[model samples]
Target: MRLALGVQYDGRPFRGWQSQREGGTVQDELERALSTFAQMPLKTVVAGRTDTGVHGLGQVVHLDTELERTEFSWVRGTNAFLPQAIAVQWARPMPEPFHARFSAFERTYFYVLHVSPVRSAMLAGQAGWVHTPLELDAMRQAAACLIGTHDFSAFRSSQCQAKTPLKHVHQIDIRQHGNFIHFRFRANAFLHHMVRNLMGCLIAVGRGRYPVEWLAEVLESRERRLAAPTFMPDGLYLAQVRYPEIFPVPAATLTSVPWSAVWSDPASSS
Candidate 1:
């Protein structure tokens, strides 16, 4: 039988989602726990792979197995052996055709920034910090220019292995709450470090280092050198993955950050 699982993890504890030879990865830990439960080795394919220090609140993965267990057993049994920072949120039988990565139609990410003169030790690995005040209006204007299908070479990392730099950005929403600013993005797919690189540019605009028009100029240039430095990964979260209705994968709630509720509440905006 084929099964799909919703996974949540604090990426600060490991080296990202892929299983590495060094073995300190979310995939490695999850496979280890699943293997323990199945009494045999099990491998999983994730919908998206994240970078180090990037958290996942609604990541989905699928695996094929011969072992039969109740859905509750799958969740409880596997999580029993998993580390505290990683969890199997839900598990369900899936059609053989349902692939975690390929079946995904869209992916959403949220980048949270804490803007203040003094940083908070409590939010060290939980949010990106900006000592300078961010201009929300300027950041919003810059973000609007990036909405559409375009060759996002400027935002892509040289290490990216994606065959094409062309990507469709469906929407970019910027919201501010007190000293925190949220940059929410929805796209058909993302290139490696694409969101982080874009965040770097947006931060520059918000900080008065760049004009709003610079964002469009950079996009048109298609030069990575013309973009700002890739921002920190601490605040990036894989917030959602959308699949077709034919696939019955349950919607996984975003729980990696405390401010996720702000995304839905209209009153949270500055």
Candidate 2:
């Protein structure tokens, strides 16, 4: 049977999402755990691959398994064997053709930055701390310029393996509250390190290092080096994965809220 899984992981301990020859990785740990729990070889496909040190709250994956175990127990059993940094939140039997990566409709991410003279001890590892203050309104304007479909070659990582530089960015929201600044974005898909690169460009505009018009200029140029430097992965979060249709919930559970509501914050939309 095919099983879909919702997973959360702290990317600090692993090399990246994909399996590696030397270092640990989320995929390596997950495959090992699934193999032990199912007593059979289980291969899994993820919706996205987060770079090392990134985090995920709503990452999705699909696994092929021969055992017929309760979906709820599969999650619990997997978590029992996995390390503390990775947990399987839920699992459900899926149709044979269901694929976590190819079937995904949209992927959302959040990049957090704490702007202050000094980094906050509370968010030291979770947020990127920039000592200089940034202009929140300017950042919002810069992000607004990135909305809609475009060839994001300028903003994509140089090492991106995707065949095309084209992508549809549904939205890019910039928001600030006290010292916290957030860049939340939604898209049909993302290239390697795409969100972090956008965050860097937005910060440049906010700090007056780059003019607001520079964003559009870079987008039009389609030159990878024209964009700002990539921001650290500490602040990036795999916020959610949107499927084509409502997925089955575990037995006796109430219907889930819409995917939009799961991470919606009007305050961040501006």
Which has the greatest TM-score?
Answer: 1
- Assess the local accuracy of residue 177 in candidate 1 as a C-alpha lDDT between 0 and 100: 82
The residue ranges of model 1 lying beyond 4 angstroms of the native Cα positions read 266-270
Highest lDDT: which candidate? 1
Q: Which run of 10 residues does model 1 get worst, by summed lDDT?
A: 261-270
Worst ten-residue run, lDDT, model 2?
250-259
lDDT of candidate 1? 0.91
For model 1, residues 97-122, the per-residue Cα lDDT tens digits are 99999899889899889998999998
Q: Compose the digit string of candidate 2's lDDT tens values, residues 4-46.
A: 9888888888888998887499999999999998888888899
Give the C-alpha lDDT of model 2: 0.81
Model 2 segments more than 4 A misplaced:
246-270
Clashes of 1: 0
The per-prediction CA RMSD against the true structure, in angstroms, equals 2.0, 3.8
